[model samples]
Target: MIKVLGDSHDKEMYDLLVEVTDLRKFVEEELHVLWKDVDEVRVECQSRHASNGNASISTSYIVVGTHGIKVPKPNMYNNTRNATMVENFLFGLEQYYEALGIVDDGAKIANASNFLHESTQLW
Candidate 1:
């Protein structure tokens, strides 16, 4: 990975890829998770690159085309950084994940970071 993606943001993906000793186990246990996780990371980077900092949409709801179906966006978590709030956030986040058809733990974990505020990111 270093040779291929040298001096780039490839550390996490490289680590996951390099630790796979068994091909069959990799396919069964790691392949899909890795792909989804990497894809999530790439999508995040691409969005940041495209936006160049101002990434939040102006509106909290998205309107689908002609039908005018409006769906509320998922809530950003960690306003107060309390345990109860975190639990509520997780519950709401899991529901959001379900609505988006995101079932894998890797993708869920990846998505969680995007919703966390700076105050709770380190915590």
Candidate 2:
């Protein structure tokens, strides 16, 4: 884990990334309880070089209240700071949850188990 300092917007961005991680962890745990059928629900944060090799999306989660970006392929010689990467990453994550129809309200938590079951269904 890398440590960031300073109170600039960059720091704010880093904070946002931390928040994203927390949210992912929370959701993953909820999934565990909500969907008892499966014991393992892996929420991965992947960061790799892009085909073209520009900047990479190192962050994979963020707060739903703000812009949530997802993971992007890493770029070579990209000057993007970690904080900026994290903020954009949150935006991506938000998009992912929206696509998955994941509601922030606690109402859906109970149905998480069913959600998982349906997600893996071949039919």
Candidate 3:
């Protein structure tokens, strides 16, 4: 997610139309130009969206281990007896991740491996 959208100017009055609408439009226009394979951007608009978005997304992997919320672990997958409820197991796992603030995919997979029974661990 974008932490900040645009540059901050102390002397300038807060103009929603210029700062928000126009800046968003400039980014959209640039994206359209890129989609069209054109480099016709002659007018450079003041924007910090790229760096702000990158900074936020780059630090996204640093996940908080827990948020102090109670989330019961899903039932272990022992055999085909619980295979019919596989969807429930997946949903519970997702809730566990969200409640525990687990954002990194690698961490989620590694932690989820602990919930798998020996009979289903190969899958």
Candidate 4:
């Protein structure tokens, strides 16, 4: 289960919960674009073994800020700092427009006339 919390003081902001079997798919499809507005996220995971073995459960928290993302060191029982998982999560948040040849240098000028007319009305 994953829970997302928005601004605390704002009543309009609500919490979101997501249950998933695959973390990679959830990160790429749902969380990639949601990083813009989400302030904090909590993830809970559980695994059950055979009847003779014990069950295990763990939780992790991730905080998002303007400068970057923060993930604390795992506790004694929980170790979720796998290199591959961290790399994948970071890659999903990256903006690759330039590398993908999607940049448009003249995009601003294309709408410059409309912007200027709107700006004049504001005066």
Best by lDDT: 1
Per-residue alpha-carbon lDDT of model 1 for 83-116, expressed as tens digits? 9987888888877766665554555675577888
Best candidate, TM-score-wise?
A: 3
lDDT of 2 by residue, 21-87 (tens): 9999999999878776442332221122233233322222223433444533222222344887656
TM-score of each: 0.39, 0.25, 0.43, 0.15
lDDT of 3 by residue, 1-123 (tens): 233433344224466556888889999999997966543332221133244454334323435667556777778756555655777777888777877777766567767778778968887
Model 3 lDDT, residue 45, Cα: 15
Error of 1 at 100 (Å): 0.6
Q: What is the C-alpha RMSD of each candidate to the true structure, in Å?
A: 21.3, 25.6, 16.8, 28.7
TM-score for candidate 1, please give it. 0.39
Model 4: residue 109 alpha-carbon error in angstroms: 29
Candidate 2: where are CA atoms >4 Å away? Answer: 1-7, 37-123
- Per-model CA lDDT versus the true structure: 0.65, 0.46, 0.64, 0.34
Backbone clashes in model 1, listed as residue pairs: none
Question: Residue 83 CA error for candidate 4 (Å)?
Answer: 0.2
Clashes of 4: 0
In model 4, how large is the Cα lDDT of residue 53? Answer: 37
